[model samples]
Target: MKIVLASASQFRKRALDMLGVPYEICPSRIDEKAIRDNDPASLTRKLAEEKARKVASEHLDAVVVSGDAVVSKAGRIYEKPRNLAEAAQFLRELSGGEFQFVTALAVMHSQTRRMLSTVEVSDISFRPLAEGEIQSYIEKYSVLNYAGAFESDAVLFFADRICGSYNFVTALPVSRLIVFLRAQGIKI
Candidate 1:
């Protein structure tokens, strides 16, 4: 089966590539910021499902994999940082604190009326960061593209502890994806 990755996230693409899966990239164009009044966990699943369905509507011969994440501290949801100021704020809120990275994945095949959704949770503890360090990293990485305003692989924002799959926190759960694909007979 032809595979379609319904997102533009480089990290997720890399994960699929590492497994030698040949897929097409078709980033969904839903206005995610417009979603409100839903819980973080629910939102993650809904967005993934929405993206998968949107792409599935256009392609009948492929299985589309889509995912979304929400970084939650207490109960507030942290999306991709809009600017340096918001990025800094996200860093501060997560400083020396443990938060949950909730990622949801959706696999859809329009031909079979088959759709699957999964949520993987990763606990991340941020190291205590200095103001200067935050600013420096923000300047270097340009936080417009990263969710929660940080990257685990980047030196400036390292997680002291992680309790779940690292790839899930990065926004794609590979093992789960494989399982989902197999369930649909879509060999990855």
Candidate 2:
């Protein structure tokens, strides 16, 4: 079966590449900001499902994979930052605190109309960050492009601890994806 990824995220693409699976990119052009839910997990899953469904409609013969992520802390769900200032704010708020980094994945087989979905939650603790460190991180990497305004790999120095699948925290949750795909008769 043909495989397609319904996202434009470089992190997700890199995760898929690590799986050694051949796939095509068909970015789902959905207005992500329009989708909202009070629960972070539910919101991420909804977004993932929507993205997969949208791409599946256009590629009826392909199995489309899509995912979404959010950082939840103190009852607030943080998605990608809008700008550098927002990124800095997010980092500052998260400094020296533990937060849940939740990610959801959806895989749809358009022909069979079968779908598999799962959510992975990871706890991440950040060391107390100074204003200068936050600013330096923002200037060094594309922090505004990532949920929570930080990337695990890029912010290793600032991350005090991470408990869960590092891959999931990074965004793709490939281990879970592999299991789900295998159950659907897809060899990766």
What are the lDDT figures for the candidates, one per model?
A: 0.82, 0.87
The best candidate by TM-score is 2
lDDT of 1 by residue, 30-140 (tens): 888776645878989989999999898888998999998878899888889888899999988888889988888899987886999988888888888889988888888
Writing each residue's lDDT as its tens digit, candidate 2 over 1-188 gives 88899987888998788889999999999999899999999999999999999999999888899999999999999899999999999999999999989999999998887889988888888899999988998999898779999876644787788887665444879988888777666887
What root-mean-square deviation over C-alphas does model 1 reach? 1.7
Q: What TM-score does candidate 2 get on C-alpha atoms?
A: 0.95
- Model 1 stretches astray by more than 4 angstroms: 155-157
Span of 10 residues, lowest total lDDT, candidate 1:
150-159
Query: How displaced is residue 186 in candidate 1, in Å?
Result: 1.6
Off by over 4 Å in 2: none
Error of 2 at 26 (Å): 0.9
